[model samples]
Target: MKPHQQGTERVITSLDWLAVLPVGLLLRQVDLTGCGPTCITVSRWRPGAGAGGLEGTGLCVCKEDGAVCGSDGRSYRSVCALHLRSWVSLQSGGERIRKAHDGECKLAPVIVVSPKKIHNVTGAQVYLSCEVKAVPTPVITWRKVSESPKGVKLLEELPGDRVNMAVQVRGGPSKHEGTGWVLINPLMKEDEGVYQCHATNMAGEAHADGSITVTEQNKSKKASLLAWDNPS
Candidate 1:
C-alpha cells in the first residue's frame, strides 16, 4: 500500500494471490458521513489458479482425462464441461441435467431384438415378444394396429378368462427377457394385422413391429387342387 497526499492506495502483490478469500479478508468501500480523506478505503482482490483464474467464478477448468455421465444420457468430456452445460441449459429454461456419474454412463436401456412376421391358418396360436436389457427393469406394453385404418391403441389386459396376458421368462417378476402376449386362437380376418411391442424405462422407449397374417385353410386347398389338375 502506498500512502499518497489525498488517500491510501491498495496494491495486491502477485505472491499474495489466494484461491479463495476469507469472509474476514473481504473489504467493501462505504462512504462514512462527515469523514475526511483520512477515512478513504481501498479494496483489491486477486484469484489464483485453483480459483479458476480472475474471471473463473462459476466456471470450470476440466482435465483432459476427466469423463462423466450426464443425466441427459450423454457422456461428457469432463465434469466441468458437464456442469457448464447444465448451467447453460438452466439459463435457457430447458430440461436440466439432474445427475452425473464417473467413468462414463452405462445405465441407459438397450434393445437387442428382432421383428416377427408370421403367416398362419385360422384358429392358430401366435406369440409376440420384445427383448430389452437395462439397469432398471423396463415396462412392456402391447398394441395392435386398428383394422379400420386408424392408429394403434394401448392393448389393455384381457379378462383373464383364457390366459391371454403376456408371459415372462420362468415367470420372473421383471419383464426383461423376450416377454410378450399370447393369442390362443386368432381368427383369419380379425387377427391379421400389425402388432407392436413397446419397452420403456428411465432411459428411453423402444418398439418392435410384429406382422400377423392368418389365411383360410380351405382357400389354400382349392388353389392347390386347381393348379395340380391343370399342371400349370
Candidate 2:
C-alpha cells in the first residue's frame, strides 16, 4: 500500500493493480486503481500465486539492471532486486541485507602452510611444501633463489635444469585453495639453498621462502659413528 524508499529508489508495495497489467509491460504514473495516479513498472510476470508468483498477491519483479554483492555474501541481479529481497527478509523476521560491493567477491592468495627449513644429508630425499588459499584458483610456482658469481640475486623456476629436483602442484585440501611441493631425490650440496613458493591470481599474489641444508654423506656417517661410540 505504501512505497518503500531506499536511497533515491522507491519500491511500490501494492500489487493489486499489477494483476491486470500484461506481463513485461512498463507503465509510468498510469492510474489503474481508484486510489490515485502512481508510477509503477512491472518488468515481467511469472505464473503462480505466492511470494514469487504473479497472482494478485504476488511480489513485484524488478528488471535486470546489474549484478551486486550483498552483505550476506550472496550476489543479486541488481540493487532493486536486493532491496526487494531485503524487504522480504525483514518481513519474515530475518536480518536486513545491504549491498557489500558493486562486483562479485574476490580473495587474494593467503599462505596457510609455509615451507620450513630442512636439514638432510646428501643422497637423501627431501620435500618442501606450501599451501595457499585464494579466489579464482591461483597458480602455484616453485623457484630456487641463488646468488650469482657477481653477488646478484637470481631466481630460477623449479625443475628447470635440475635432474634430481621435481615440482608438483595440485588442487586443494579445501575450496579455492591449492598445494605445491618441491621434491629433491638424491639430495646434493648444490640443492642446499633457498627455495620460494609463489601463488598468484587476478586478485593478488603471495610468496614464501624456505631453505635446505645438506651435509656430506661420509661426514654425516662419521659423525654418527663418533656419537654412537662416545654417547654422553
Candidate 3:
C-alpha cells in the first residue's frame, strides 16, 4: 500500500484541564488548538455574576436605625442587614443562617432608683422594692445584713413559711421589669435593719442596700395611768 500524507491530529485525553467556574460549572470541551463556543450555564453564572454574595446586590442596606448582635458573635450594622445576610446564606447552601437579636449583645446589671431609707411604725405593712435591669435576666434575691458574721440569707430560704413573717420576697408581676421584697408586718424593733438586694446573671453579680427604720409604738398616757392606778 502506498503511504498517504495525513493532517496533524490532536486528542484531548482528559477533562481535568477544564477550568471550573466559581459556582461549579465546567467549561465547554474544545480541541487542543482551541476554537469553539464556550459553554454558558445560566444558573451557575447567576449566583456569582449578580446574586448571593454578601456585598452589593443591594443585600445589606440599613433599613432601620438599630444594630444587633448575631448568633455568630458579630455585630451587624442593622437588623435588615442581618436578616439579608441570613437569607443569602440559606440560599447559597452555606452554614445555617442565624438571625440577629434586637439589641447589641451585652450583660450589664443596674439597680433602679429606690428609697434610700424607709420608716414604718409597728404592725404596718411596707414594701421594699428593688428593680434590676440585666441581660440574660438576672435572679433576684433579698438579704439582710447581719450584725453577726453568719452573713445574709436568701429571703426564700428563710426557715418556716412566710404566712406570718417579718418579711416576704417575690417577683414583679411583669417580667419586663424585675422583682422585690416586702416587709409584710414589721416588728417595732426586731425588723429594723439594713437590707440588701442581690442580682446575679451569667455575666456576674450586683447588689444594693436600703435602710429600714422601725419606730416604737406609741401608748396613750391615759391608758397607762389607768392601768397603773387600777393594778389588777
Candidate 4:
C-alpha cells in the first residue's frame, strides 16, 4: 500500500456557528476541520425551559469544503454538540413537529401539570400523583409557592426542606418505577406549589408541572383543640 498525500483544513468559523444557533442566540463562527459527511442536527435553549438536545431536531448533511455531499442535500453550518441542543428545541414546534424523516430526530412529549387548587384553614390528608411519562421516565420534586396557612401540616421530604423527596414505588424498576407519587399525612397551605416531574435522558430533558391544593381538615382541627389544655 502507498501513503496518501496531506491536504489543507480550515477552522470552523463563527459564521458557521451563526448558521446553526437557535433562532435567538447570536451566531458565532470559527474555522475548523470538518468530518467528511454527517447528518446535521439543530437544537435550542428556551429561557425558562428544560434541555432540548440536538438529536431531536433537524439534521443537515455537512461535508468538507470539497467533499461529495449527500443527496436530498440542504445547506448547513458547523455547530458544537452543546449549543446544538438549543438550536433543536426552538426548531421543534407545531409545524416542524409533524415532519418525520430518518435524518431528523423527534422530541418526547412535554407535560405541564397544574395540580388541583384547593384551600384549607384546618389540616387535611391528601394523595396526589405528579404528572407522568415513559421515555426518560420523569422524577418528582416538591416546592412551596405560597405561604403556609396556619394549622396546616405537610408531609414534606423533610421538615424545613422543600426538595429531594424520595420516589416512592409500588413495584421495582423491572415491574414499575419512577412514577411520581406523593403522600401528605396532613396537608396544609404550606404544601402548595408547582410539583414538577422532570424527565431526562441522552435524547433531551422535559418537565411535567402540577399544582397542589390543601383542603381543610375540620375533624382533625376539632380533635386537636379538644385535646389541648389551657395553661391559664
Provide the lDDT at 120 for model 2. 95
How many pairs collide in each candidate, listed in order? Answer: 0, 0, 0, 31
Whole-structure CA lDDT of model 1: 0.52
Rank candidates, lDDT, best first: 2, 3, 1, 4
Backbone clashes in candidate 3 total: 0
- Residue-by-residue lDDT tens digits, candidate 2, 1-232: 6556543334445533333333333323223342121123343344343466432421233354456778887656565555646756788899998889885457789999999999999999999999999877889999999999999999998899889989999999997789999999989998999999999999899999999999999999999999999999
Which of the predicted structures, 1 or 2, would earn the higher TM-score when compared with the native? 2
> In model 4, which range of ten residues has the least summed lDDT?
63-72
Candidate 4: RMSD to truth: 18.9
| Model 2 lDDT at residue 72 | 85
Tens-place lDDT digits, model 1, residues 22-44: 22222222222322222223233
lDDT of 4 by residue, 1-232 (tens): 2222222112233333434433322222222232212333333334444464222332233322221111223222232322233334446651211212223232343443434544444345554554433333434454333335785643333224433233453322331124455556556656656554455544465654456655356765776787785433
Candidate 3 local distance difference test against the native: 0.53
Off by over 4 Å in 1: 1-108, 147-178
- Collision pairs in model 2: none
Candidate 4's TM-score reads 0.32
